[model samples]
Target: MKENLTDSAYAAGWALVKRLPEPVATRLFDGIADFVWRRRGKSVLRLESNLRRVRPEATDAEITALTRAGMRSYMRYWCESFRMSTWSRERVLASFEPEDVHRLDEAMASGRGAVLALPHMGNWDLAGAWVVVRGMPFTTVAERLKPEKLFDRFVAYREGLGMEVLPLTGGAGTLGKLAQRLRAGGLVCLVGDRDLSASGVPVEFLGEAARMPAGPAALAAQTGAALLPVTLWYDGTPVMKGRVHEEVPAPAEGSKREKVAAMTQAMADVWGEGVRAHPGDWHMLQRFWLADLEPRPEESVLPDPQGVQ
Candidate 1:
């Protein structure tokens, strides 16, 4: 009953937001962000804590200011996502100006496929829509949320935008399916900053230890695909901005396990650079640093079905 209520509420909210005028929606979201920030809600506090790791040198006042901006940026992502389905192809293409898109273009042209690893910043759905508008639809995994109806709604939403949505809980075969898609010259985009699996690869990020998903690296290594790190951020404009970093080449020599670890760490390093440049744009509202993580009970770990480290 509770799950149904939550799902219905979210669906209703999305419907209402989608119908709102752009200016009205923007103003409404701004007010919502201000209220959340002023209330010091849990999400806002978590975002502030994550920002501290990105900008270690920031004083309390600076962190406070940054958190408020981060809340606004996060709200903007939600606003854009709710309305993106109605965006025209031309508008979608124009909304995202990706720097170094040729890197992805070249990889696709080479028939080697491309693995785009991105952190949770900016409006990734906008970036994905741009890719689809350019004639290549990508595949990505979505975490199954509570309330099956809500999960289905999200899958439908992304699919409506030309993404092939795969369930993350689809078991061991999920990685094989992604690898197969890559080998066939398909694009696979993975959110690489946070590790959702139990067997994530540990790496140093923003001067602290944290685990990140290794699926991007593993997929590239397994299929001989180009691994590219991409970052997205709003530039205080209606248009979203992004950059595709140079490919993080697979190791010339190493065991498969060793190579996966090295590549994941390299991905983290590049992500750190982007986060530092646009600290408020990163929407990491959960505990990320190892120091901040609470202890978990010991259990026998199974291999990640997604092939993440």
Candidate 2:
């Protein structure tokens, strides 16, 4: 499993992006989206399969249109992440409506420490960066990218924006840090809708069973953290729109699995409301439900959040 080729490809792509201006980046992304949509290869096939899984009743033409929209959304996220350094704080804050900020404020002021759960729906990196600019730093978990160079580069970029990325390494790395922050009344944001790691708990989504990461729910149960689902949608606007759900009730007095399942359902309900409002903004590019068919034989050593890191 040599990752040199993958690393090289991404590095080259990012290098080209690093040199582009905002307007040029937008145009380049639009072009890339057009190119990806016109193709009928693995990328298109995977997108079509995911669309069918999520929206089975959609017509073939409807699925194709959704795939194109997903591709564009995905590209827009990448482009925006690269351009984050160039964005002014005023521009970033202006991206969200005042009502959205009000909901987030209400959730955070609950004093239980808000866990902003986002999906792969929109520009989440940008969303987190926006919070940082607004003077509220948050903790989010990310699986380390392959090739140490790329991983370090991403960490540097994110940390520069006041985010503390917890890497999914063995023992007290990311998750341990997350618990400490939450207990101390810090904001913890996680993307709970998709389990990119391929190891997650099965939950009903969009009227079908889909697997999502159990970490957010598990953390909520372990600690009395408030879980809030947040999503951003483009909606043909230069500045995107955002939605936020109030802090969900954490199932603390239940069995671990039951509590996690309840929390997962709460998260699913929040995300479902957002997706229904902006179906075109949902950006899952690969198959999600079928990943359970794949085995997760190797379990990593996860640290106890109660233990001090």
Candidate 3:
């Protein structure tokens, strides 16, 4: 019953938000963000804590201001996502201006396939739409949500945008599917910043230890695909900006396990650069760092990267 209520609430919210005028919805989201920030909601608090790790030297006043801005940015992502399905192809193509995109283009053209590792920042859906417009439809894995209806809704949403959605909990076959896609010169985008599974690869991020999903690196290593880290943030109102960092190639000399670890750390290092530049756009409201996590016995054992593949 509770799951049904939650699912219905989300469905209703999406319907209403999509129907709203752009200006009206933008203002409404701003108001909502302001209210959440003022109330110090758990989401806002978690975002603030995450920001502190990004900018440890920030004063209390600065942190407070940044938190408010972060809330606004986070709300903007929600607003854009709810309305993205209504966006036209031309509008989606114009919404994002990418930097260093040639790296991805070249990889795709080479027929070696490419793995795009992205952090949770900016409007990733917009980026995905742009990629589809550019003529390369991609596949992405999504975490299973509590309410099955809600999970189905999200899968439908991405599918409507021309992406092939796979379930993270689909077991070993999931990774096999992704690798097969890559070997066929396909694109696979993975959210690489946080690990949803207990067995994520440990890495140093933003000067602290954290676990990030190893699927991106493992996929690259297994398929000999180009591993690239991409970062997205708002350039201004209604415009999204992104940068594709240099590719992290699979090390030819290391063991597969060592190569995966090294590549994962390299991706983290590039992600830190982007997050630092636009801290507010990073919508990392949940616990991320090792220090922030509660003690769990299973954490000591690395989970198979295939779990998220």
The window of 10 residues in a row where model 1 has the poorest summed lDDT is: 299-308
Error of 3 at 218 (Å): 0.2
For candidate 1, the per-residue lDDT at 108 reads 99
Candidate 3 residues lying further than 4 Å off, grouped into runs, are: 295-309
Superposed model 1: Cα runs more than 4 Å off: 295-309
Model 1 lDDT tens row, 139-187: 9988776677888888898899999988888556788889999999999
Rank order (by lDDT, best first): 3, 1, 2
248-272: candidate 2 lDDT, tens digit per residue: 7866477899888888888887787
- Candidate 2: worst 10 consecutive residues by lDDT? 300-309
TM-score of 3: 0.93
lDDT of 1 at 50: 85
